[model samples]
Each structure stands twice: as C-alpha cells, then as structure tokens.
Target: MRGVEHSIQLVPDYRVHHQAPYRLSILEATELKRHLEELLRLGFIKPSNSPWGAPVLFARKADGTLRLCIDYRGLNRYTVKNSYPMPRADELFDRLEDNRFFTKINLRSGYHQIRVATEDQPKTAFRSRFGHYEFTVMPFGLTNAPATFQTTMNNIFRDILEEYILVYLDDILVYSRTLEDHIRHLRDVLQRLRKHDFYAKLSKCRFAQRKVNFLEHHVSDQGLHMDDAKISAIAECPVPTSAKQLRSFLGLTSYYTNFIQGYARYSYVLTSTLLRKNPPWFWTPLCEDAFRALKKAVTCAPVLRLPDFDCPFIVTTDASDFAVGAVLSQGKGVYQFTNKYGANVDGYSPIYTPDEWSATGDTYAAGTQGLLLWAVTLGALLLGGALLIFNTSALS
Candidate 1:
C-alpha cells in the first residue's frame, strides 16, 4: 500500500450484476484457497457483500504455478475507458542513438502496486466456492489498468523522462553515453523508486549492459535490429497446406515488414489466395515462387542504420508496369519501401509531374528515342536502369 492511490472512478449510472461462481476441480479448489489465504494475509482483499460479482479463474504461469485471476469482462463493459496517452515504440527506439550503456528494470507485480478507488472497490468483487471477496489493491484484467499505471509512472519520473530514463508502463530503461554517467542515472531512478516504495525484481533486471533487448527488438550503439530468434522461426516455418495455415504464415512474416524490401510485391500472390471464396485452394507456380523468394529475402535482410538528421539522405526510385520500388540511403546504410504491383494505384505510376516529384528535392528528367530517364539527383547521386523485353512465346 506504499504507492497506492485511489484514482479510478467508474461511470456513475452503469451497474453490473453478480456472476455465479465457476466450478473448480479438487486440486484447483485447494490452490484457490491457498492463494486467497495469502492475499488475505497481505491485506490485499477482504470479504465483501457488494452487488457486483465476477467468476474466478486460474491461469498457469511460466514457472508451472497457477495464478488466480478474475473474469472482469462483466465489469469492464460498464467501466469508462481512460484515454491517457502512452509512448510509441518507434519514438522510444529513435531516442537511443548515442547511448552506450543501458539498464532495464521491471517493477514487481506492477498493477497490484496501485490501489483502486475506495468507492469502486466493491465493484471489483469476485466469487469462489468459499465466499465473496473484493480486492483492496488494483487487480489485473481491468480495462484501464495499463493507462492508470503509465500515468502514475510518468508523474513519478516526469523531471528526468527524456533526459536520463524512458519508461513504458512497468519497464524502466536507463540510458547514458558513458558508464560513469549511466551509474548516476541508474542511482537517481532507483532512489526515486525507493522514495515511492516501489520494488523491482532484481532477477529480471539487467544492469550496465552495452546491448539490451527492449520492446521485443535488440538495441545497441550499432543500431536497432530484428530479433534473431524471430528470424529463425520464419526461416524454419513449413509450407502451408491449408487456408488457415497460409493465413498464419502470412501474419507471422508481416510483423517484420519494415525489415524486408519489396515485401508487398513478394506476398501479393499468397494474399490473393485469401480473397478467393471457392472450396479448393489453388497453389500455383507463381505463388510458390513468391513464397520462396520472400523466405530468401528475410534470411538476407540488411541491418538498418539509425538515421542522422544532420546528414543528407539519398532517395532512389524505380518503376515498371508491374511495380515500383525505392531506397532511401545515407552513407552505406539503406532503408527500402516498395508498392505492390499495379499501375492504376496512386503513387505507383512511372511518370510524375515536376510538382509531384519536386517534393523530395530537385527533379531531373531526361529522355532519348527508346529510353526514358526519370531521376532525382541527391548528393553524390548514382542512377542505373535495366529493361528486359521478352516475347509471349517464351513465357508460354
């Protein structure tokens, strides 16, 4: 109760009825009793006769222990959502450009550390075989739980947010350009947590590491990169034999679309299968080639460099009747963006008006008898083009 504050207020008019208790196995009953006893001892919950009640459920943890949870779906429907803003992952990653030292800290049972509003406590009541109970501290599965916690953390560390530390919910990342500076920053954050009586799980914390994984992506002084384990999973995935399986495959690969060049074009044929409404799934040769090409592209995806605003950027573009592709580069590092194959789609056309192309920079277009030249000269520009004219008989 050290950092507890009663701040959550549900809508005044909405009310929820009690849900009946769910049946539990003998072992599950015993486990529930044990957990309830511990919560009672800690003064986190108390016996209640509130009008509202939710069923209790047990979820298995990673360490092979059962975690007692409440079915909050009934109560959540009536609760007003909190619209507090949370930091974007991309913006957080963009701030780590020159940091050489890093430390990550995770708060212990983060949501439970906060207290529910006094008037709303009865609204969180849950039922089991023994009796009805209500939580004194905030519990998991609440609709606005994350927003509330994030607001609390932000208020606590508002002074040093972007300067020395970045917090996303319970995850605290301390970053610095030097080891000496990093130690001071870490100490400041720890002292603030101590002042608020917040505790961190030391076993889950990493201190003074040059490279650390944050927000599911690996980060270092070098730059940000996709997780190797995720890449391996994509490479090892077997060919899909059913519609459901094909959808799963596409979903997994699409997560890393930023890492792959021409991703949309490569997955175009595979996605067309999903649009068809017939019984039979047509696995054509074109689809097979696209699938194999995508897998190969992921395996050889380039390491994206962190952008430097002070340096000039190079934009290279190519357009054919089928597709359009572009690469934005600075020095030897590059990031590519491509549109799916189709000429009628907006911004996919090979021809662009001077005004349309001039937004990027100066526009330069030159043409000869049989060749068309469309170019934009960036600093130290390099332009190349190739045309492959083929006969219909050869393809047949």
Candidate 2:
C-alpha cells in the first residue's frame, strides 16, 4: 500500500459523473456522519472541491451493520479496469501439501491501508448529504481496487509467498507441517507485517490451528472439506419458488463441488430449467427429488484428501453421447483450483444426462467398447485437458 499507489486509469474522453447524493434515513445519517468523522480523523479522507463526484450511501451487512459506501457505477463506466490476476485457491491448496498446522492473519481495514495515486484521488471524490469528500486511500467499490490491493499484498510477501505463506489480498495464511516450524513461520510473517507498517486485527487472527476455514472451504491436512455452516444452510433451505432462488442455492452448492461426486449430474435437472430465457416456474416432483438428492449429497460430502504425487492415481471417467464425467482419485477424492472469490467451474461442468455420470454403471457407450484404463497420476490433471505428471517410462 505504501510502496505502490493504486492507480485509477480511465479510458479516453471519459464522461465525468457527479451524481446527487441519495437521501438517507435517520440511522443511515448517524452512521454516515460517524464514519466520516472517523475517516477524517484517520486522514483517510478529506473535504473535496473536485468536479467528479458519486453518491454516498449505506450498504447493510449480514450482521445488520450499515457500511458507508459510494455508488461508483458512473465513475467505473469510464475507468479502465485493472485485470491483475489473483492466485487460484486450488493452487494454494496444492501447496498446503498435508501441512498439519495453520495460522491465518486478517489485516485491519485492509483497503484503507493503501493510498490512491495522488492524481486519481480527486476522481474518487463522492458527495454525501453531509458534504463532498475525497479518499486519500483506496476505497471500496473502485473498479481497480481489488487488483491494486492484490498487487500490493503480492509485492509485500513476494519473497516468502508460497513457501509457507499464502496471501489472498488481506488474508495471510501461514501453514507448516509442525508446531516448531509453524512458530518460526508465524514470526517471519509477523516480522514482514511489522517491517511494512501493516497491522493485523488480533481478534480475527488464528494461531496454530490444525483446521482453518478459508475461502469458504475448511482447509486442513486432509485437503479441503465443506463448511458446516454452509451445509446446514443448504439443508434447511426451503424448496425454491423461483429461478433466482434456485440459482442462489446452486451457486452455494457449487462452491463445494469437490466434496460432492456427481455434483453436475445431480444438479442437471435443477439447472436445466435455468438455461432457458423463460424457465418454467413449477417445482416438479423430479426437481424436488433432484433437490433432495443434492442436499443429501452435500451433507454427506467426503474429506478430499491431499493428493500424493508418489501414489498411483485412479482416473475414473465415463461418457455418453451427450455428456462426460470424470473423478480424479487416489483412493479418496482430490480436486483442485480456486481464485480469490470463486472456484473454477470447468472442473465441475454440468452433466447433460443422468446415467452418463454414474460411477458404477457400465461406462461404455451403448454402441462402443474401447475402454481406456490409463494411469492418471498427480494433482495437476485437468478435467477434459489430459493432465498429470510421473515418469511415463513406469507405464512401459
């Protein structure tokens, strides 16, 4: 955040938007005023006379706290996007490599730690019922904020990143195989934070945990497991009354697709209706059955053991005229991949037919018979792309 200022590059002849502030309720007004005072005290923001302005509003959090936010849709339209890539969660998991100990560090007001590039600070000015103000540091909702923040974190931890530390923006996870090693790694991470003048919220930080909940997955030496809270939500969910509701359920379930075999298969009937421009609203018996089956599958999801490259992998795959399904296993399932916020969907593509994904059914096509039983070793394998590693001479 200090070494690199977040730059907000705009496209040519961008239309400057200075929208009027939205009316606030009594509670919102109180919260906004309080936040503005705090931001001013911290020197994170200042009174502005900039021509470019956006509206300020309050966004409700899950815990019901009102978060002061700016509507940046108008400004973002003209802003050039920062497409800096983030490390995938799946690749991060692979690096865990059966580490038995874990420590997670959550930074305090992560984005606020970063300064917006001097020239772009004026462009970040937003108008509120109280007054017009501009941010000195990067504020939430900017188009390039994520990329900027991610770049900052990567640069801060570049030397030790992926050795024992994995960073996703403000979340720094230091993992090690033993308590002794973990202690040293933790110190190193803390020293780095201290060196860079970054601060962590001690209350939100976990130390020497064998199991850690991160990126929506419960990560441990046993690979990634489904989060119980999310599973319970899936279990208690009422049947969907609309397409939007159903898609929400699917999105939640899809995040843990690694733990659920035949996920795409079980979810097909439920998802097919959503593909059409105008999907049928009826909750048919088949859809209900599929829904129940999916819930049951998620609740009973298995622990995806970390893949061992030394072990021989069992590549179980099947295909029908319309669909193909595959499971990468080493006795237990070992799936991989994650971005900052989402899992890779390609590995869990929707199954077109039911029986096509069945693991026990005859895997052969109705009219074909050349069954291949090639060894697929390593965690590097992709679903459709032929993947994996090991000396090919061993097969010979």
Candidate 3:
C-alpha cells in the first residue's frame, strides 16, 4: 500500500490502460449537460476557466472494465475522518458460522450507485496529469466515502437484517440450509437490489454455494477459518511497547471473550492500571501473567452456541476483588464444569454465588445448600400458581 504516490502521474498511453468499456451507459450530450449541472449543484465539479478542468477520466478495472474515477487525490488529504465503523472482518466471519448455503453478490462499481449531493460534490474535485475530474457518485479514498457507503447499506438492509441475511455495502449474503427457504431469501435480496436501481457484477456473485469468500475470509458450514495471510499477521503481532499496544492486544483478545472462562479477571491488571495519564510502561509480573493467560485462553476457549432469548435465563457467576465473571446460559440441559480449586471440600457444587465462593473454601457446599433452599421456595410458589390456574380454568 506504500510507494503509491500522493500525486496522480499519467500513463502516457492512457487509452491503453483505460481501454475497457464502462459497464454503465455513457451519457448523451443532453444527459452529460444535466450531469454536469448536477455536479455543480453537488459542488464536486466547479466551473473552471482552465481548458483541462473538470472533465471525466475513465480507467480500466483489472478485468478490462472501465471505471469512472474522479482524481480527488489533492482534495482528499484535507478531508476529515468520517464517523463510521468499517465492517469488522472478524464480526462478519463469525456471522456465517451455521450457514450451510450462501449467496454472494458484488455491486458493479459500488460507489457509482450513489449521487453526491449538489453542494458536497465540488469538494471532491481533483486535478490529474491530463485534466480535472469530479465524481458523479462518491469516490474512493474520500474520508466520508466509507461512512456514506455504510449508511447506504444500513438503509438498504433495514428490513432484511432482521431475518437470515447480512449486507456489507456492495456484498449481500443470503444464507439458509433448506432449498425452499434459500430460494425465497435469494429472491428477496435480488428484489431489493432491483428496487434500488443498483447494478450487480453478476460475474462475481455466488448463489447457493456451500462455501464462499466474504470480506477476504473463507466461510463454510463448518465455520470460518482465518484467512491464511491474516493468521500470520495476527501471529506476528508485536509485543506490547506501550499502553496503546497493550490495549490493542487486550481489545483483540476481548472479541473472543466468550470463549474464555474468566476473561474479566485475566484482563483486570492491564485494564485497571492503564487509565492513569502517566502509566508506567512496565511489564510487571501481573501484566505478563495476564498476557500469557489471554493467549492460552484464546486457544482453549469454548465454542458457545447462539443464545435463545425465549428460554429461561440460567446464569453462572463468580466474583473476585479483581473482577466478577458471569455466563448467561439460556438453554435447558446445559453443563458447566466448576473449577476444582474453587470447589468445596464436601464435594457439593454450587449453582450461582460469587461472594460466598470467595468467603469460603467450601463455597461449592455452601452455595449448593443455599440454592436448594431457594429452589424449594420457588417450587412451592410455582405449585400454588399452578393450582390456582387449574381452579380458574375449571371454573371458566
């Protein structure tokens, strides 16, 4: 990504590189005038006296396809960072875990679908070696381009995201196992695209596939595997140089926190101490312990199933001065192994009580007895309620 010049250097034989036909239809003279007027309103292309100013420049995609590029290089450097989250590669991968069937759709020059507002367009204008050009739609590298695209996607997927579909801007993935449901999902996505007047690069879309590449990662029914290149990058993450580095590592580790048994306790040392303005860059024993524990936790992390919110809330909790940890388990007939070191000498296991555990070596026994007392009380209440309901139903 480096060594790419900040300036636009022309290829003398621009036509050779820009040979491919634009996938979109070229504007007729009247339409061109209308577009130019639109750009004037949007402020992307201004009226300039320079003979070479604000003419469109076209370039070929790798597949010999022409893309309309507004050379906004000079202007982009001054732009402010847009407030939007780029799609997290990990989060996207995690979403496709149980998806057996998938469809991938790529937009035909995704940014071209959007028309920059009249006043905002001129700020996007840039000078190239040959001439000045401005974007009819949003351009790449603009600080706001990502935010704009994300907003566009969020609006488009407002309805579909509630179901079994996910949209990442130009990429729309529809997933299902059953053929009937899969067909319906695919139709729904395609219909939405048509309604929006968005063009897709059909050559890039995959329909009803068992596996697919999504946001640079390969996903299948088996689950997502780290991209080979990305695995090396993660492995080569440098050791913490400062608090920022420590935080970065901790943040990355936190993404997989569900897998760790006591992540809060493990991360307590670093997260608690680093907030001071002049935090020492010392790798103390506790910090090193936390660092090692997090790495181990990542490898041994449990595979948690997606929660079923309708079911009963079953929670396991343990507390310490350093941190309190809890797992909210919803499904019936779930198993949680108690830590032997934290268990009671009496061989009785507790259901939920963090404070008692810390106070007693036999917390398992103590918690279990308390749980029994609570359960008996709950059972009596439930029995009375059931009898009352039965009497009411009989009377009705």
Candidate 4:
C-alpha cells in the first residue's frame, strides 16, 4: 500500500477546466463517479487541465485508472491550417497488392510528446476557478495539430517514402510480405524517427504481423476486408418506414458504394421518393426490388485488383428512372466510382411508341441514359488521355 501510495503521488493531479480545486461530484453519478473518486483517492489517477478551459484529455496512467480531462475544442479553432499531404485510401491499398502481411502502430499519447512552439503555447489558454494552466505538450483538439504532425513525420521518413507507409496523425502503418522484409521496413522507420528525435511508445505499437486493422479495415494475407464493426452498424439499421429512412439507408450503403455494381440503379427508386416534400412512404414492388437489388449487389461484389496507370481502363455505366452512374474499372481488377448522380427524370419508356411515351418519361429516361453513357465514354477518354500524357512526358 505504501509503494502504491508513493507511485500515486508522482502522478500529477492537475486541475480540471484550467483551474485548481477541480471538483467532481461522486454522489450524483454514483457508480461510475465513485470509481473515479476511489481511484483519485488511491493516488492512481489525477486531474488533467486543459490550456483553454476546454475539457481535459485523459491518458491511462502507468497504473490502470481514469483521469479527468478538460475539453479544448474552443482554442483549436484559431490555429493555422496544416498543409500536409494526406494519403488517398485507394492509393495506399494499391501498394498492398503483393504484400500478405500487415501491421498497425499507434503512438501512445501522440500529441503530448511534441512541444507546441513556445510562442503558440500561450494561445492554448483556458479559464478555470482555481487558476489557468497551459499545456506543456501539444494538446488535443487543435485544428492544425494533425496536419503538422503528419508533415513532420513525412519529413522524417522522406528518405524511404517510396516504400509502403501510411501515416494518419499518430498511427503509422508498414506493409510487406516476408518477415525479413517487414523487419527491415520497421528498422528503417524506427531509425528515421530516432534521427529526427521522434520517440514512439512500444507498448501501444504493434510490430510486423500477419494481419492488422487500420482505419477500421481488416488487412491481412487475404487482402482488405470491411470492418466487422461497420457490418454490425449496417446490420443494426432499422427497416425503412419512410423515404427519409430509405435515403439514410442508401447513404450508408453508398459509403461502401464501390463494392457494389450498379449501385445507383440499385438505390434509385428509394432515393427518388425522398426528394419530394411530405412524400408518402410507399414500399411498392419497385422499392422492394431496389432494396433487394442493393443487398444482392454486396453479396456478389467482385474483388477488384489495384490499378496501374499504364493499363487500359474498361469503363462501364448504367441508368435507371432516377439516377445515372459509372465505374472506371481496370483489367488488373481495381476499380473506382468516378461518378453518380440523381436525374430529374419524370418518367420514360423507350419501348413505347412515340405517342405512348409520355413527355415526362422520355425526358427522364433519355437524360438518365444519356448521362450514364456520357460518363463512361468520358471516363475512358480521360484514362487514355492520362496514359498519353505520362508516356509522352516519359519519352521526352
């Protein structure tokens, strides 16, 4: 107990809300609050003061306990924008084609390690009753912190930038197939960080491994997978009761829209009904068809390979009463959804005679089909143009 007490004393009980006498009511919340109070009393935890009277951000002490933190959202609004180059998701995934191993590393207390430039340190001020305390290290909720940190890291690893690497704030990923290759990559990463005086907490980092989760995607020898958590979220979706609910469902599916073929047509009917004010919720045969079509699309989704700029693109497109969509798919198996949009289609049937086809229907169908075809042709031409540009420059 004495040793435990001494360890607690070393952990600072900083003020909360930028002031001393940090008060927390253990009585009102009872269960959870009591847990916090007990930890504080045992010296296992302390208050974390924020510079700008915002909420404090808490970190797990060497001892397992919760600490109070202030919110710093207010001060971060005024920071300068960070002009860092962020990696595109598809671009990052493309590099993993040959690799069967993956590893994810997260920095422990990432922002806390870096000192905010002394002049800018004063800007992170927060008000509290006891007194104001400023952040000795970079505080959370800063607008520019992410970009700044990312840029700093990029510079540190610039020498080996061509290798497989992705950095998002404190998270760094290294990918390779062989154990030996991964070890070499990890060594290079660590050595560069050392050269730049950037330290990482090993406890929070996972070194080269067969599979890892990054940005919620499960990456492994099998390739990238939709996160189970995301699947669960989709599963929890309530059945559509109105056009609004249906639209929300469509939006969710659209987040993984690339995985599905003809996604726009699949979601067309449901999306159409939602655009009108006070629209009645009608799950007609068309709506049911669209809904089932979307679900089926996911189940049969193709495994697309990565795109190579040198390869030719096989562009495809389709249209429906309400929407037009196109995919810029490459033969190597990789594809990207270049365009999708809702059309102001009134209604149209091409099979109908000139007299039978209503003005509204023809206009809608024509616009939808025209747009879809146009998108595909344009996408193909763009890819060809890009190839030409690159080759011409290379030769020159």
Clashes of 4: 18
| Candidate number of the best lDDT | 2
lDDT of 1 by residue, 1-396 (tens): 365564556678876768899999898899999989988998889999999899998998746888888999888887889899999765676577678898989989888788888888998899999899998888998888888889889988999997978899899999999999999999999999999988899987999998877776667876767778778878888887777888778787776665666666676667755545754887788878888888887787655555454544444444432333444345433333232232122221111111112112223322221112332422122222322121111010
TM-score for all predictions?
0.72, 0.82, 0.53, 0.61
Q: Best by TM-score, which number?
A: 2
Worst 10 residues of 4 by lDDT: 1-10
Query: What is candidate 2's lDDT per residue for 1-396, written digit by digit as tens?
Result: 467788888899998899988999999999999999999999999999999999988888756899888899998999988889988877777678669999989999999888888999999999998899999999999988889888888887889988999999888899999899999999988988888878999998989999998777888886778788899989988998888898889888877776675676667777666545796688889989989999998897766666565555444444433334445555333333222123232332121111223233444433222223322222234233434322211111
Of candidates 4 and 2, the better by lDDT: 2
Off by over 4 Å in 1: 1-6, 21-38, 57-69, 129-131, 232-252, 275-299, 316-328, 332-396
- Local lDDT at 311 for model 3: 39
Error of 2 at 90 (Å): 0.6
Please give, for residues 216-269, the per-residue lDDT of candidate 3 as tens digits: 555677554334454344345666879888777877665445445666666766
Question: What Cα-based lDDT does every candidate model obtain?
Answer: 0.70, 0.74, 0.53, 0.53
Task: Give candidate 3's error at residue 311 in angstroms.
Answer: 4.0
lDDT of 4 by residue, 155-217 (tens): 666666547677767778888878888888888777766665566777767777776777656
Rank by TM-score, highest first: 2, 1, 4, 3
Give all candidate RMSDs, comma-separated.
9.5, 7.4, 14.8, 11.7
State how far residue 359 of model 2 sits from its true place (Å): 17
